[model samples]
Target chain A: MYLFSAHNITKNYAAHTALKNVSIDVSAQTIFGLLGPNGAGKTSLIRIINQITAPDEGELYFNGEKLKPHHISLIGYLPEERGLYKKMKVGEQALYLAQLKGVPKAEALKKLKYWFEKFEILDWWNKKVEELSKGMQQKIQFIVTILHEPKLLIFDEPFSGFDPINVNLLKEEILNLRNNGATIIFSTHNMESVEELCDNIALINKAEKILDGKVHEIKNTYKANIFEIGYNKQEINFNEIVPQSYEILSDIHQNGISKIQIKIPADEMPNQLIKYLIPHMEMHSFNEILPSMNDIFIQKVNEQKQKSF
Target chain B: MIFLFKKLTNRSKNPFKSITMKKIRLIIQREYLSRVKKRSFIIMTILGPVLMASIWIVPFFLATMSDEKKVVSVVDETGVFVDKFESTAKILFVYETDLEKSRADLTKEKYSAVLYICKPTNSIPDHAMLYYSDKSPGIITQSYISNAMQTILKNNLLINAHNISKEDFDLINRTNIKLNTEDIRTGKKSYTEIKTALGIFSGILIYFFIFMYGAQVMRGVIEEKTSRIVEVIISSVKPFQLMMGKIVGIALVGLTQFALWILLTFFIITSLQIAKPDVFKSPKTEQAFDAGQKIPSADQIQLQKLQNQEIKEMLTGIFEIDYGLMILQFLFYFLAGYLLYASLFASIGAAVDSEADTQQFMLPITIPLLFAIIMSNFVINNPDGPVAFWLSIIPLTSPIIMMVRIPFGVPVEQVYLSMGLLILGFIATTWVAGRIYRTGILMYGKKVSYRELWKWLRY
Candidate 1:
């Protein structure tokens, strides 16, 4: 069963509509990547799910039941622009935030101690937040978000300020949480992390969802029928031998080896192009080219931008 | 089990109704503990009493301390005043016939000043020019010399015009009376001076708490907003609850500080009283007069005695008040006044992005408080005047003005009405502030204005 879903949510501010009929389903024990460009209503949808804001029209469900206030305790949110009290001690602030999420004070302290030790920041327990570096503060914020052992966690731009090493550590922790039966929804501009971590993604463009599927399926759905061929020959012109069903996109010859990219019609496949080229050229290799999520995101957003203009 | 099931079902149906209390408690705990732990709060709490006790203790200590004797050489050009300047507690007059000799002797540092008493002309010339090398003598020295001359002149005129003896003249001049007012309703008589002091004390106390604690609430909100911790906090608790937590938390801080001040002040005052019982006693005569010099007449001694009696009466009048009830009402008015102003301050804090942005909106909130404080002086003077009555009824000004009238014995119906209206005012402002706070906390980087605040209220 899906752990959470926002069905047809719409939100309007005084001067703008932040979200319009955007719906997303987050499955259990899986990472849901909310992909969008800036100002594409990702935060709006997250806020709606968190109930920080009420949708002008929508319904929310958790585990196939209607969402309610008690569900708030079950979900932890790390907002894009999160902070801690500058003058407050690190452990005290973490414990306070944990208790705010409904964890009892003793449990909060115990959990915070464990997390502090795990992060190797136990020495920072009595230090003020202002005394910590930005990266260190982000670690504290991360610990606060997960200290309650919430059923679902939402992280927005969670990797913005981290070094690569810490980013990898954070990604590992996030995946570990998912493996331990907690659902996660994270939003970011890092398509590489999305490819590495997300099981499912929904791409939003201009307050609307343009693509939604399992990550591999979405990548496959946007792939063109193109193949790259390498031949033993020094040079080759495809104009004479290529059929109308296939056309050469690029041809390059270097050091007695020839490489050519050919696009096939919708009715044709990469195998058919290979079949067409086999008679004229000795094939060293043939491989299909699939678009990355970054290309897909740009193409979809640009296409939607064109459609609107 | 049945009750638990019913509660679960009800909460599921209307969760918001019951979801706020636990969160609000957490927020209040954070605010109160964080502020109480701050070094500034601890320092202010300890310093407040020392400062307040100094107001009453410093003057009394100075009055009772050992006085340095000052000798003034009187170069009396008017022979009628030679050897007539009587010595008092600090000042000693020595007759000097030669003005040049006195002027030359002045540098010896044995004398404080040289008093040149010019002969009385057609009118009482601004008498007695005083000269010193470096420092100027105090006003008391000149006033004392002039007063002695006036007394002698008045006695001479009375003796010549009425053919009366000096004893009769002395008896007539020593008249001392005090005004006592009786309440028509209770038939109880009391001094007007005590009532005025009590009225002003209560009014200023209310005024003080509202300003001090109200600004604290505003500063706390601004800190949360600027530090960007408010969003994390408000996500767990409602904005209204957050605002309320801060308001009540800071109010408790103010109350704690006030209680500490009162307790410490009383302790310090009593300790000093026990340590030096004569600190507040009657003034003593300690000047060294020449053995052959004339002493001050009995009339001058009687005058000093009358002044001492006045001070003793003022002290006794302070003890005559019904302190328990006054303190209870003071707490009520202080809390109500604080609530009313703190809500307005909180809204101002939420509407602005920084402390610098608060200046534009501060005027409207502060005007009524300033007006009430300024009008409280008038209220103390005329507690039954129309202005005082109307101001004590208006919710904004009533918190202060009513306290001023209460110690002078306000009508019971008016107190209840004022209290009711003040509570209503607090609730109304809190609701309005909650609206502004909810909208403004989430809004960042925008320059907010009064018009924007109004729109937020509508939202």
Candidate 2:
């Protein structure tokens, strides 16, 4: 059973619809990527799930029960925008915010200390929030959000400012959270990270989910019979061995090597081409290219635009 | 299940209400500890009372210590009014010296002034030439020379004209007036007017703090909002709790400062007395003087007499104030008033998203605080009047206005009525403020105005 399900969610910002009949059931202990470009309704749906807002038309279910304010305690939300009290000290402020999230003082402090020390920010406990660098402040915020060990963790562009090393660090922690039986929702425009982290993907374009499925399945579903052929022989005549079922999209030849993109009908798949071409040509490499998440996003968004007009 | 529900539906209980006592404690602690801890606060608080004490004690100190006298070389060519100067204090008469030396001595400030006596002829010059560069001498010194001249003239008149006996003529001129009276009514119990003044003063102090500290709360809210920190806090805590926490925290700070200031004042006055015992000495012959020299002309004299009578009435009225009642009412009104308006200030802080948005709402909140000030003065004049009753019963004005009227002898019924209404107003205002706070803290990027606030209140 899904731990949380947002069924047919619809939200509007005045006259503009931000979410249109969007439904996604996030199962327990899995990382769900709510992937979208800027201005997509990913944030709107997340806000609906968090109950920071109410959907104009939808139902929210938590473990097969209706969601209420109490459900907030079950979710940990790290918003994209950074917010911290400038005059408040880091440790004291973190503890206070954590308590408000329902952890008692001693327990909150215990958890906060562990996170602070783990992040090597124990000395920052006494310093005012303004004294810390942006990354340090974000660490404090992250600790406060996760101190309760919430069941559902929603990260909205969590690693935007992080350098490569810290990015890997945060990525490891995110996976650790999922491993610890916490269902996660990762929202970002960074498709490479999504590919690395996301188990399932929901692509929102123009306030609509144009595509949603397992990451591998979605990549496979959007695939066309496209292959890249690289060869040392530059003067190959594609008309000799290539079937009429295939079309050459791009060709490049330089430095005694040739590279070409061939789109073939699924009936004449890559295996059929290989069968016909091995004797006719000496091939350095022949590979059917799987569509990447970036390519899928671009293709889906363009398809959505064309459909809307 | 019950525990889970308690965690969830604690909604019925005010989200802000849990932090009530602690927030107030923290706020007051912050205000008090921070302010009183500063060296400047300690110095100023201590200095103010010391200055006040010296104001009361310094004159006597001056009169006692002032033994040095001004020596005037009177070149009285005319023998008139030489003896008139005898009544003046702090002046000495010196024998005539060379004109060049006296003029030179005046430059050195050897004498306070040099008096040049001119003979009065049918053509008397409008002014007598004083060798000293100073425009005027002390009245006491001037009177001394005048008295000396008068005595010499009197002696001359008696010697030249009537050849009257000097002793007999002096006997005829002396006279004194005496009076005795009984009050028409006796046993009238009057409150010490100073005590009443103290109450009104405390009331005004409370009034000013409510405005000043209330704005501090507003500014605090604005700071958090401008820095964008409020958004993070709002997500975790209800806006009402946040506002109350801040208000209560700052109020604690204010109370702490007040207590520290009182202690410092006591210290300052004590040190002052110990350091300078002469300040407590009684004056032998010090007198209040007119704004100008001597006296004004006849018409001016009549106007001055009327003004003096008015002043005497005011002094007497102050003397009639009831100290015990005034103090009690002052405490009640101060707390009630501060609590009442502070909520408004807190609400104002919450409504406007940023500091820049505060000015538009500042006038509305500030005007009532000012009205309390104006009404405080008014009710001081007419304590039992209908206007006083009306204003005091209204919780907003009651704190300040009732405090002023208490010394003037407000009835027990009115005090109770005012207190009751003030508490009720607080309950209502807090409710309204909590609503506005919850709404406004979440709202950003919108210009909230009075009309809009009204809409929010309705919502």
Candidate 3:
């Protein structure tokens, strides 16, 4: 079942359109990556989902119900440029934000204590936000964003300011939240993290959703019929052994092994390439090559750019 | 379950109504607490009463504190003004026969100035000259000497040329006329002076409160924007709610400070009065105390009794004003005026990325307030005139101009109309400001212009 979805979303500012007929459906308890380049309407769409700004034309549903103001209480949003009140005490600000989301003060305090202890920032609770380091402040912001235990959390570039270790910790916590039935909408240009964590993704470019599906399915759909072969070099000549109909992208001879990348014909199966290659040489390895999300992101955006021109 | 049922019903009726009040309350609570807990707010709260009390007490102390006495040597060539000069606490007069000797003594710093009265070429002396080395005589001293000479010469002329006796002259000069004004409708003594003072005091107080608290609202908005917390905040609450919550919260802060100041000032003044009853005595009584060595004659005692009666009448005049109505109107105008301007300030703060960029937007907002203040004197002088009537009716200037006219017995209908118009104006400005603020807070790194703001309004 879909946890949240935006249908035919359209938004415009005075000078230009921010979004155009975009649609997205995020399934329950899945990490949905919203990928886009700078100024690509990802923020606009996220804001629409958060109800920070209403879409000029669209309908949004949460848990199969039309989105309303009350839905805000169930959703936590960490904007790209998120911040806390600088002069406010860390714990006080956290509790205030939680209360703003409709969490009672006692419950908020209880949750804050748990999170603060888990994040090892309990000592900094009484310190003003300005006195904390940037990473520490970001941690506090992260904690405040999720303190209400929202069902749907939207984080825009959540790992931008964090050190690698903290990023991993945040990643683990995000996964843990998902494991506890919380759905996450992650927006970022960090394709590696998308590859590592996202179950599904929608690629938006120039205010249009050009691609979206399960991450593995997208990688599979974008993958060319290409395979890499690693075999003993002294035993065979790669050019002579491979069929002339096949396209050899690159062939390299290093040490005692020869590795070559070749594209199979549409009629052939992956096993066919392995079967054809195994007869000629003692193969060490044979594998089909799948595209990375980064490669597909670049290729799709570039293709869209060319099509527009 | 009841919460869920209510939420469902509210959603069906109006989708945006759910949780708004709670969120706004949270925002207000945070805003109020953060400010009230600040060191500066505490300092100002304590300092405000002291400053106000000092404004009343400092002048009295300064009046009683004696200054260095200035001595003037009189060299009357006419010999007709001897023994006529009177000495006050600050100035003393002494007669000298030799003009050259007086001049020499002045240069030697024996006297502050040497006043040389020329012999009369006609009925009155044509001119008089004053000489000193470094320090010049004050205007008060110069006028006092000239007045003394003029009075003595006039009496001499009356006695010699007109053949009038001193008794007849004294009796004719003592024909002092005093006019007591009464309101014809109420048949009560009218206190125009006290009413004018009250009007000006309240008007100026409201004007100051609006600016001081309005700027605070703007700064608070700017702080939220600069810190980049506005996005997170608006995600939870509507921008309008956030803006209003801040405005209302800061207004409460202003009211609290004002209430504390009034109470503290009253307490301090009363305590001081009780601790040293003599310090709180009337200035006339204080003067009598200053001249402790002199025993008051029968006439002096009668004059003091008359002064005491006048003081009592003044106190009755102060109590005669409808303080309840005046205070109610003051609060109404204070909140109305502050809300009107604070919304504009919030929008300006949202439109700019920094405080430095607010100057351009601040001009238009400040102009009406300044114009109202500038026209207040005219309004006070001619409360029933056309200029005052129109200014009091216009919402932008009414908060101050109407206040200046209120104490002078403004018609109830006109006050009602002015108040209704002010509320409408506040609503209109808040609508425009909320529109601008919603768009402006999300926009960054762009230098917003008037055109951009216009576009934001449309958006």
Candidate 4:
């Protein structure tokens, strides 16, 4: 079942359109990647979901109900430019934020202690936020963002300031949260993480949603009939063995090995190419090459840019 | 997550109909606690009363401390003014024959000044000159010398030319008049001076507090914006809630500080009076006591009775002031004025990315407050005049101008009208400020102009 969804949301600033008829649905217990380039209205959509700014024209539903102020406590948001009160104590600020999210004071303190201990930042509890390093502060922010254990958490560039180890830690925690039945909307420029973590994604560009689906499904749709073959060098030229109907995209030979990429016709089977190449070359490996999310993002955005002109 | 889900289901059954005051209370608690716990607040709380008490006590000490006597040498060219100069506690007069000798003595610092009386060319001397080596004689000494000389010359003229006896001249010059002012309606003495002082005191205090606390509210906003914490906060609570929470929080801080200052000032002044009773005595009372010591025994009782009567009149005058009404009005205006100005300050702070950028917006807010202060003197002089009436009615200037007219017994209806208008003004400004603040806090890096602010208000 869908945990949260935005329908035909449109938002506008004074002179520019921030969002235009954008729609997205996040299913329960899944991480939904919100992918876009800079200034592509991704932040605007996230803000609408958080109710930080209401959409000029649209509706939002949380847990199959119309979104309201009470829904605020159910959703947690970590903005791209998130910060804590610099002069406030670490534990104090965390507890305050949790309380603002509608957690009882005692419960907030208990949760804060658990998170602070889990993150190994218990010693820094009394220290002022400004005294902590940037990564340390980000850790505190991350803890506060999920302290209330919100059912729907929205993270905007969640891993921006973290080291690789902390990034992995955060990734594990995000996945762990999803396993516990929380839906997450992850917005980022990092496509590799999206490929690894996201169950589904919606690609927005120029204030419009151009693509969205399950991760594997979208990849399958964008995949061409291209395959890479790796083999040992043989007497016959590897290029000559390929059918004339098939297009050879690249051929490279080095260190007694040959690697070639070829695009087969849609009418032809991939096994037919293997059948033709078996007798001519030593077959070590053969695999179809699918487009990475990074490649698809750039290609789609570029295509949209061209269409706009 | 399970807990949140359950809570969500429960809340979704009955969604919030309005912005939650609970969240705003949390914000207010944080804002108020963070400031009240600061070292600066503590220091100021303690030091404010000390400074205020010193303002009351320092002048009295200074007045009684500077009792150094001044000696003036008289060099009368015509010998008509010999033995005529009288010596008092502050100034002493001595006759000298040689003008050049007295001038030299003045240069040698033997005398404070040398008064040279020129011989009369006609009925009276045309001009008289006084010389000193350095630091000319004070106004008191100068006026004293001139008055003594005038009396001596006039008496001489009266006795020689008009054939009037000294007794008749003395009796004629002793006609002193005293005017008493009373409130015709209540048959009470009208203490215009005391009331004027109270009105101006309260007016200036309100002005000072509004600016002091209003700037604090602005700085708090800028801190939240520049620190980038506002986004995180507004996600949980509305921008209006956050803004009002901050304004109200800082106002409580201001009220707390003011209350502490009043209590502490009273305590300090009273303890000081108990410790040093002589210092608390007015200089006039002390002088009367000194004169009593030197005068006859019977006159001492009379002087004491006169001093007691003066003190009693002053006490009665103080008791006649409507302290309850004054305090109530002060509190209302202080809070109302602060809320009005603080919301504007908060909007300005949100519109700018840094404190330096607030300069362009501060002028419009400060102009009315400054104009009210400048017109306060006129208001005090003519409380019921058209200017005072209109200024006291306008909400922007009324907090201060109306306060200036309050002690002069402003009509009840006009005060109510002014108060009602001030509340309406506060609500209106808060609405505009909330609109601008919500949009401005989210915008960054761009220089905001007035046109941009107008657009934000519309948004």
Candidate 5:
């Protein structure tokens, strides 16, 4: 069952429609990635869910209950642009913000300490936030955002400032959070992270969701029945045995091996291509390849772009 | 863990209370802590009291420091007023020959300038002419010479008329009558009562500065709101709580710093009491110190008293100050009066995002404060009168006006009425300000004119 759902959400900024009937059903205990380029109404939709803003026409349900003001306590939001009182001490600011999220003082501290230690920012706790480096500050911010052990967590560009080591640490922690019953919405421009982390994705472009499905399924749906045939120093002709619908994308000799990548139309499959190609050429290797999520994303966006014309 | 604890404790109490009060406390705390914690607060707080106490000592020290012998050279060309300029203090006299040389020489070496006295010339517009260059002779020297010269001239005329000896004239020298205030009410209502009223005036001055500046604090919050920091804070807490927390925090800071100031002042006055007891002492207690030291004699006191009637009347109820009441009313007015202004300021702050934007609505709030200050002066001048009655009843101006009248003794009814009005003003202003604050907090980059602000009030 879905733990969080935003149905038919729409938001208008005067003459501009920021979000139009955007919907998502985020399942519990999974990382549901929100992938979109800048200004695709993701922030507007997130704001509606967080209750920072009200949608012009939509409703959100959380944990099978209609979302209310008090439901804000159930969701932890780490905004893209960080806001921390510069003059306030790190610890003091963290506890204050956590308490504002409705966490009791003693309990908030216990959780905050656990996260601070896990993040190794406990020593920097006493110093004023302004004194900390940007990365360190982001870590502190992350700790406070999740200190309440919120049921659902929203992080926009959560790994923006982390180095390689910290990035791995954050990834481990994010997975840990999901394992601990927190559904997550992670939004970013980093497509590699999406491939590595996301269980499902809703890709929005031009304030509309263009693709919404399991990541692997979407990638598979975009894959052409293509095979890379390799032979040593072979001259190949495609017109006779290969169907006219088949297309040669690349035919190159690399490191003394003749290789050719061909695409078959939807009516044809890679097995049929392999069957037909064996009789026509001295085939060294034949393989079918799946498209990357990056390719699918770009392809789908381009499809939308083309459809607009 | 500890970090979270500190933050919670440091954060204002649960932010879900009334917003204006919250904002006031926050801003007051911010101003108080930021200002009080600074080295400047320490220095100024200590300096204010020290300066007040030294007022009684510094003048005497300055008077003593300036006691060098000041010479006066005179040439009585008309011979009408001769042998007039003589003094045994800092001013001394020497007669010099050649008027031109004396004038030049005196100007060169600072001989209190030469006085070239001439009899009333027919062509001269002024009846008497005394020539000096670029300086008034020090008062002591000028008074001595002018007195001696006038006495000599008068005696000459008297001798010509009646042929009396100088001794007879000296023995019977008499002046005109003098008028001085000897209040019919005595004992508990004497000089101390007058001094207490003066103290009350000081208390009122403090209330004004706080009231004025406290409103500034409110305006500052509203300015910040207009700028959009309120949104940044509101993201974490409820609007009302945010408002109340800020107000309480700021008030605490103000109280802390103010308490520190009072303590510092007490130390300053106490030190002065230990160091320079003569001035701080009552005039009666200091009579012994005046022995053979040129204290005002009975005739002189009477004349001085006649000349200073205006100051005496202004400070008439000075000795009747109620210290506890002054403090209590101060706190009441401070909170109520500041809340009233701050509520409006917070509304303005929420409505507009910047100081420039706030100007369009600032006058509507500020004019009343300015009027209060102006009206207070009037109330002090005419205590217990009709104008004072109306001025003291209006809450906006009442805090200052009533305090000004406190020295003059306002009726108990007026005080309670004024207090009630001030509180009512706080509530009404808060309601209005809250409306503006709620709408304006989220509105950004928009110019909020007074008309817009007024509309916000309606909405």
Candidate 6:
């Protein structure tokens, strides 16, 4: 079941329309990546789901019920431009945010203490936010976001300020949150992370959802008929053996092995390419190439821009 | 990981709601406590009372302390004013025969200044040259010599030429006119001068507190916005709630400071009175009458009795002021005024991204306050006039103009009308400010114009 969804959501700010008929479904226990370049209405849709803003014209649902003001406590949002009170102590601020999400003080304290200890930040609980480094502050904010165990979590550019090690740690926590049955909406420009973590994804550009589907299915749909083969028989030239229907994109000889990348014509299939390659050379490896999300994202946005112009 | 799963599976029921009273309370608590614990808040709280007390105490010290006495040598070539310039606490006179010798002495710094009395062109000379080394004598010393010469010339001419009695001349010189007023409605009489003073003092105090604390609220809002913590807090609570939480929290801070100032000032005044009874005691003006000469026993007794009567009237004038009602009205006006202006300040804080952008919006909010202060001077003189009535009834200026009128005992219905309008005004501005604050807080990196603010109001 879809844990949360914003259908036909439209939002405008004065003369500018921030989101127009943007819709997306976030299924339970899955990571939904909201992909877009800057100023593409991604933040607008995320804000609508979080109920930070109401859509100009559409509806939002949480757990199949019409979203209401009271449903905000069930939603946790870490905005792109997020911060803690610079002068506030970390533990105190964390507990305050937890209680603000409807957890009682005693429960919030217990949960915060556990998380702080787990993160190995118990020693810095009394430190003011301004005294911590930016990455450390991001960690504290991350803890605050998940401490309440919100049913729906939305993170906008969550990995921006994090170092590589901490970024990996956060990616682990996000996956962990999804495994625990919390539906997550992750919005970022980091396509690699999206490929690794997101089960379903949507791409928004110019205040419209341009593409969306299960990650693997969308990648397959955008794939070009291409195959990469590596063979130890370095004496054969790829151009002589390949058929006219296939084209060799590149060939490189290294370590007594010849590797060539070939793209077959649209009518060909991956198995035909593989069968043809195996007969011509002692194939150690043969694999068809599927488009990466980054390539598909750039192509789709560019396509939309061209269509509009 | 198991703990996360167990809680998730067990959480079939929803416990969270949007913008709950509980959440607002938490927001308020956070805003209040965080600021109250700040070093700046603590420092200002302690410093507020000291600054207020010094405003009153510093002038008192300066008034009571005497200046060093300066000697002025007089060369009366006219012989018309010899031995006339007597000594006072701040100035002494030394009569000399040779003008050149006095000039030489003045140059040598023996005398602070030399009064070169030219030969009298007429019965009363118009101008006199004062010679000194480099700098002129203080105004007080020069005024003393000028006044003594004027009096000697006028009295001598009146006695010799007009054959006027000395008693009549003295009586004429001492004549002073005072206006007596009685409130027809209350049937209470008072000296107008004292009532005017009470009115001005209370009006200035209200104006001062409102301007001070209202700006504090604005600065607090700017701090939250610039630090970018407002959005995180706003996601949980409505922007209206956040703005209110800040407004009310700072109101409490203002009240705390005001209460401390009142209590501390009272304590300081009381302790000063007890420790040194004469420190604030009003000095007798009889010393001025006794200076330069002596009077007959009969006249002296009569003068003393008259001075005693004047002091009594002054006391009665102060006692006749309705202090109980004035203080109550002061508190009411102060609070209403603060709420009315503070909401506007909060909205301005939200509209701008930083302190630099506040200038455009600040002028409109402050113009009424500035006009109110300037009009209060007029209001004090004509408390019952139409200008005072209108200014006091209008909510924008009422807080100050009304307080000025209250000490002079305004009509009861006018007071009710002003207060009713003030409350209605506060509610209206708060609603308006809440709207602006809601949209403005979420709007980041946008240079807001007046037109944009109006659009936000509609939103």
Best by DockQ: 4
Q: Comparing chain B with the reference, what is the TM-score for each candidate?
A: 0.89, 0.68, 0.87, 0.86, 0.72, 0.88
Q: After superposition, how far is residue B401 of candidate 1 from its true place, in Å?
A: 0.9
Decoy 2 TM-score against native: 0.77
Using Cα atoms with residue i matched to residue i, what is each candidate's TM-score against the true structure? 0.92, 0.77, 0.91, 0.90, 0.76, 0.91
Predictions' DockQ, in order: 0.55, 0.31, 0.61, 0.65, 0.19, 0.54
lDDT of 6 by residue, A1-309 (tens): 888888898899877998988888889889999999998888778777767778899988887778876766678889898888888898898999888877789999999889988889998999989999989998888988888888889999999998899999999999999997788999999999999999999999888888999999999899888888888855776666668878888888888887888999888777877766677677888878899999999999999889989
lDDT per residue, candidate 4, A1-309, as tens digits?
899989999999889998999999999999999999999999999888888899999999988889977878888999998888899999889989988888889999998899989988899999999999999999998998999888899999999999999999999999999998789999999999999999999999989999999999999998989999998875566557776789989888898788889999987999999999887777899999999999999999999999989
Model 6's interface RMSD: 3.2
**Candidate 2 Cα RMSD (Å):** 7.2
- DockQ for candidate 2, please give it: 0.31
**Any runs in candidate 3 off by more than 4 Å, and if so which?**
A229-237, A251-259, A269-287, B1-18, B98-164, B172-175, B284-310
Model 6: residue B278 alpha-carbon error in angstroms: 2.8
Worst 10 residues of 3 chain B by lDDT: B289-298
Assess the local accuracy of residue A91 in candidate 4 as a C-alpha lDDT between 0 and 100: 87
**What's the ranking of the predictions by TM-score, best on top?**
1, 6, 3, 4, 2, 5
Model-by-model lDDT, in order? 0.83, 0.72, 0.87, 0.89, 0.69, 0.83
Return the lDDT, model 1, position B214: 88
Better of 2 and 5 by DockQ: 2
**Candidate 2: where is the Cα deviation over 4 Å?**
A7-23, A35-59, A70-73, A203-211, A253-258, A266-268, A284-309, B1-101, B115-196, B271-277, B282-328, B351-354, B443-459
Q: Please give, for residues B3-113, the per-residue lDDT of candidate 4 as tens digits.
A: 656665686455454337677788888889999999999999999999999999998787678577788898888766898776665677888989988988888999999
Q: Where does the lowest 10-residue lDDT sum fall in candidate 4 chain A?
A: A234-243
- Per-residue CA lDDT of candidate 5, range B384-411, in tens? 7998788778877776667666655567
Q: Model 5, A1-309: lDDT tens per residue?
A: 898898988887654798888899999888988988888888777767777667888889987778766566668888776656666678877876776766777998988888888777789888987798888887887887788777889988889988988888888889999987788998888888988888889998888988888888887787788778887686667677677888888888778888888888888767788888777677778777788777877887888889999
